[model samples]
Target: MHKTRIGRDGPNVSVLALGGASLGGVYQDVSQGEADAVVQAALDAGINLIDVAPYYGLTRAETALGAALKGVPRSDFVLMTKVGRYGDKTWNFSREATLRSLDESRARLGVDYIDVLQCHDIEHGDRRQLIEEALPTLRDLKGQGAIGRIGITGYDLSVLEDVATTEQVDTVMAYCTYSLQDRRLAGVAQRLGRSGVAVFNASPLGMGLLTSKGPPDWHPGHPSVWAAAAEAARRCEALGVDLSFVALQFALQTAAANGIVSTVVGMSKPSNLDRNIEALTTPIDPAVLTAVEAALAPVRDKGWDVLPGGGGKAGK
Candidate 1:
């Protein structure tokens, strides 16, 4: 596991972070034992950042991660979680809700202070509220030692850029925008990095679209995007390789090259840990990568539609 400075002057952290959504069984039902193993595996592999949110399993992930990290030294890892987006259609970025949410997250994670407290899925909340109410409250929390850094997370590249530049967040997390099928995050990440905002590139598999099993029924990708990914997957299968491995490799390699801070991935079971580690260590075959990219060319950078600043329309 390689380590890098988070931002222009932030703390050093692993390039790969463990995403906690799966620990709460967001993708599949996982027992406490399995969740613990996944956390332990990430730590043992030197993956120092663990990202979670109350919305993940409706707070189950924070609780499970707390239990899994009970005996470990708090200094050994960086805890990152989010607030404001609680459900598919629920979002509250008011100052009062922000304060209460942080308290609940702290209690659930069994931590006195978080390393990085983010506004989760900010594009789903009112931009004005996030700026006028939530961000100021977070800054106050940072001043009071409730958190070390402030961050914003979302799927929209433009939203991330808009808030990160106009507001004061130390980090920005963009999902599904840096994978093989979508490279839209590259420009935004570089701009943010130059402006001293660390970028966390997440969902290397595009929320299961690049996996061998394909996207879930709830995935909101357009039909053309689905067809393009399926064709890419078929190409990877023909070459006796898993599409997810290539996708992860692409994300990790590209992030390293593009000044992005870290690449995040989720693991529900311990077995998933080994596979992710393999992605970090293995060298991707260029020929396979080229073929996969070619197959995905039709839908490259075609992000799904979402309302600006999260009003009127809801997107997952």
Candidate 2:
């Protein structure tokens, strides 16, 4: 278990984070006991950060996480959850809504203060409203010690770019654009790093596309994702390094990626978790890194959208 700082100056967190989306039933159904076990396993493994959202399982994930952390000291780990619209659903960041959202999340997670409270999916037209009205309320909550820090999560670099300019935002949990396949977040990372804002690289595995199993084609949003991932895997095979290793290591190895937050790999069983943990521990050779870059060259040349920022969509 390796550790890294959340921001250039924020508190230290595990190099790998535990993404709570799976526990919330994004990929597959999970029992409450099973979700708690997953959280316990992550904690036992020294993972310090657990990120979840109200959008995931419609708040079920937070409830499960709260149950898992009940006996543990609050100071032992960092807990993060998001507020804002999710999917086709609409949510306003009105002061009342902000208060309600935080209260519900806090009550569900059984925490007095959240380690990180992010605005989820700022691409909605109501983003400006969140910044103007909702942010002040969030800051007020921060003043009253309701949350440790305020952050925002989104799939578009441009949205992040807008959020980065705001003074109220302390952290940004940008999506997969920062990974090896999609380097779109390179500029955003550099910019946010200079501004003293912490950046959490979510979807480092491109929603599991970079893994050994590759991306799935069952969802409407995953067509290009699967294609890009398949191409990368083929290239990795040609270059003689495990494709999954390439995907995992590529994101971890980036200099711009200082915190190296959890890549958020989903699992249907404990064995999958074991395999992912094993992959994290495996040392990636320098030669493999170089080869992965070479393997991605064709996709780079083809000019297909590789990152979420550049119109590379995510699966629903």
Candidate 3:
């Protein structure tokens, strides 16, 4: 894996960071053994940056990672975790809650200071606290030596745009906004890059919407999206390839070309890790990618809200 710096002052991390939500099995049931194996595989493959959250299977992923990293030296990897979203559907972005959350994450991951501490899922909460309190709290922790850097993660582009320019944040985790179906992150990409904010993109496969299995029943993909995604998947199958491989190749290479710091992909099984590494090494067929993009035109930027009250359309 290639290396890149997170913001101007953050740690040097692998271009392909391992996302922890899949270890928690947000889309399906993930066995503990499977999670541990993938974590080990990522480390063996020279992956040093791992991103996790308390809400990922309600802390199950952190527990597994802690067990997986037991014998490894702490300085060997850059660990990052999130605060604000605590439960399956609960949030607490207050400073007090954030402090407690950071402590819990450290204990779970067996670390003294997280390399990157991010505010997770910021779209559902009050923007003022996130901007004024939560972000400053991460900075405070940095000052106190509890964290190395600070940032925010969310699916909403507008909320992300606000936090990207907060001046206190050092990184941003954007999902679904920079994928094959959406390039909305480009709207704020230049500004964030110029401001020295490292943007880590997740959901490069669009939460399985671009895969043959389609999205899980709980994913926010709309009905029209399902149709277009199915058409794209069919085209991939005809070309003797999986849509996910194409999706990952397109998204990660594009992000690298665009100068995004890293692309975070989750894998519950170790085999997926190998495939991802291979996808990065091999060149993608542009003809196939162009066909898939054309097939997805109907669903492009249909705009589904991740938060209640239909709030995901801003900054598009």
lDDT of 2 by residue, 33-93 (tens): 8887777787787878888888887787788778878988887888888776544456677
Candidate 1 lDDT (Cα, whole model)?
0.87
Tens-digit lDDT track of model 3 for 1-316: 7888888877788989898888776757888788778888898898999999988888988887887788889878999899998775677789999999988988888888799888887887777887778888888899999898887888887778786775547888888777777777765765788888888888888777778888766566677777788899999999999998988887777786675888899888888899988888779998998999999987677647632222222122
For residue 206, give model 3's deviation from the true position in Å. Answer: 1.0
**Model 3 misplaced stretches (Cα beyond 4 Å):** 305-316
RMSD (Cα, Å) for all candidates, in order, is 2.5, 3.5, 3.0
TM-score winner, 2 or 3: 3
Instruction: Evaluate model 3: give its lDDT.
Output: 0.82
**True-vs-predicted CA distance for residue 63, candidate 1, Å:** 0.5
Task: Return the lDDT, model 2, position 62.
Answer: 80
Top model number, lDDT: 1
Cand. 1 TM to true fold: 0.96
Model 1's number of clashes is: 0
lDDT at 193 for candidate 1?
A: 86
List lDDT for all candidates, in order. Answer: 0.87, 0.70, 0.82
Q: Taking the tens digit of each residue's C-alpha lDDT, what string does model 1 give over 30-76?
A: 88899889899889999999999999999999999999999899999
Deviation of model 1 at 295, angstroms: 0.4
Give candidate 1's error at residue 57 in angstroms: 0.1
* Best candidate (score: TM-score): 1
